[model samples]
Target: MFVTESFNRQLDDLLERICSKLQISSAQHRLAQDRYETIGNWLGARESPLAMFNPVIYPQGSLRIGTTVRPCSGQEYDLDLVCEVQLDWRQVERPVAVLDAVEQRLKKYDTYKTMLERKKRCIRVNYANEFHLDILPACPDPSSGTTCVVVPDRDVRGWKPSNPKGYAAWFESRAKTFEVYLAEHQEPLPSQEPVEMKAPLKRVVQLIKRWRDLKYADDQKIAPISIVLTTLAAEHYGGQQSTSEALAGILAGIVASIPPRNQRLLVLNPKNTKEDLSEKWDENPDAYEAFVSGIIAFHQSWQDIARGRGIPSVSATLRDLFGEDLTKSVVKEQAESIQKARSEQRLHMQKSTGILSGLTTAGSVSVRSNTFYGSQEVLP
Candidate 1:
């Protein structure tokens, strides 16, 4: 009942295609980068309060990790940026003051003033349908080494520690291992440049995130956040060379990494120990249950495919897992490719045999029946 190597290849191809579709296009990537750079320049201007602190703005989340996905229907992709203000936390007692300062500077620009929205720890600037930039104001934390910084928490009315850059570095290191494996074992992706390698870990994360989006399209509030999925998947990755194997491995092991909680599960931030990625799990049990169910469903679906059981067709199962549109597209493309190969094989056999429709003609039937082991007439 085990699936054949050919089937596995087909499945991997389909999954890779789906991942490609989910990726943010290069043009969009450049646009986001340009927008952020302009904002950084404005914040680092001589007259700005942030300029005195040597503020540096950079990406920190999925965009930095190369795991960014296109936003779902009617939603904007978030570009998480850290506005690192180089100042001692002790000197600036009020952390919220830093947030206020940044907001005020942004208010100077009428356009930005209208687009800005204050969040728990960051200022969000909306770019209409393109994307939203979440700028987290952070200052150096003396206790947590150089990489750590204290970000403001309006809800707690205090400063909290975080290390977005450190976390991104750790994630990038993991991503590199997969990239090297891909370089050695596979051809470069058509969409990627020769020098630019696609990491299997990134692809795996993208796939899981896309699945989460589809599953929770209606109730996004309860769905597991990107950091949770990214962290868990990266933590559980076994350096598998293939995306399908990596995904199956992650799905199987991700649940084990979730700490058991009578009330709430705690997914600790690897860089900053104080932060919990799954903090919302405590308030919404249904969301946590949904996440658990999703992992189980994903793992079981892959297992069923591997074992050739339960599912009526791979396409149907994949459609249920991903979405109807993406699944159908991949399946159709694969079917057409298979048909072309079969047709080519038939044409090749016909040419090799020199047979065209009928073999009753003299030239077509060159080998005579009298040609035997010791016969005078040799077999043509």
Candidate 2:
């Protein structure tokens, strides 16, 4: 495969760019933020019935963890959120009533009334092609202190335990551990770098989600849930420096973590021990099998990607892993970026590993400006 430090780094940067494209745009994020904040204000307003309970609305899922990906189905992006009120779970009039209260308050506003759609767990505000806001109504769980919340689940007509805030904090702690290591090693951490830059772990999660979405586009019933993927990735992550390395390691860890086919998969909520994130797998054994086979194939594809050389070959592999259209666009853009960097006399080739990148590195040489078109296309 002739993989070297420089080659691996180049691959890492390629993956990084792909991850960036898969993410929600900054403007999209801003719009979602504005919409959610306005909804938050309205939900907590004094005129609202639940205002007496002092409701607080905030983001909880992918957006909070920075692993949110753009939708591939020409559908709206999801901005998962929670509206937690200061109602006591013990004295609540009705557990499911909290959901009704939220739905009613949102319905009172004409804008939300038009946008709102009721679900088993949340009230979704669809925003067409942009993004949708899923606001889950919740109340505090006294047994677990402040971080724990009991959210309505209509399937059971009972409150379900969840800790999105706590789970986010845990993910940050895991990812930050690597950032600290990188900083100590004299490398710029993702936080200290450009806003588009993501830590390796987050990038890996983004890629997995993208893969899962595409691979199960028609078979959503068997697709693994975001929480299971995110939790497993975060749990098994060992702070690898590059997205490629982290992806490989995390996949292997998750594969090893799964039990024999006869045994059930138990992915418990990290914040709350009582909650099993993979509970749905128990009811649909085929879903578990699908997850197992899907990840196994994904891991094998990633392994093949490591062996691939050049933009065209790697791009082909990535097309199968992700999709053809997105991969082609990213590949073309990256190739142009490299060409531009070379023309500006800014590209460097690591002498030891022959890695060509815009960034300067030790034991590397600048790619000289050349005019011979036919003979100058070695990298291509």
Candidate 2 lDDT over residue span 131-193, tens digit each: 888999998886885698889888888888988888889899989966787678865545865
Model 2 residue 205 CA deviation in Å: 0.9
TM-scores across all candidates? Answer: 0.83, 0.89
TM-score, cand. 2: 0.89
State the local distance difference test value for candidate 2: 0.82
* CA RMSD of each candidate after superposition: 10.0, 3.6
Clashing pairs in 1: none
Tell me how far the alpha carbon of residue 315 in candidate 2 is from the true structure, in angstroms, after superposition: 2.5
Model 2 misplacement above 4 A: 1-5, 185-194, 309-311, 348-380
Worst 10 residues of 2 by lDDT: 371-380
The TM-score, computed over Cα atoms with residue i paired to residue i, of candidate 1 is 0.83
Candidate 2 residue-wise lDDT at 365: 86
**Candidate 2, number of clashes:** 0
Query: Distance (Å) between predicted and true CA of 166, model 1?
Result: 1.2
Computed on alpha carbons, the lDDT of every model, listed in order, comes to 0.76, 0.82
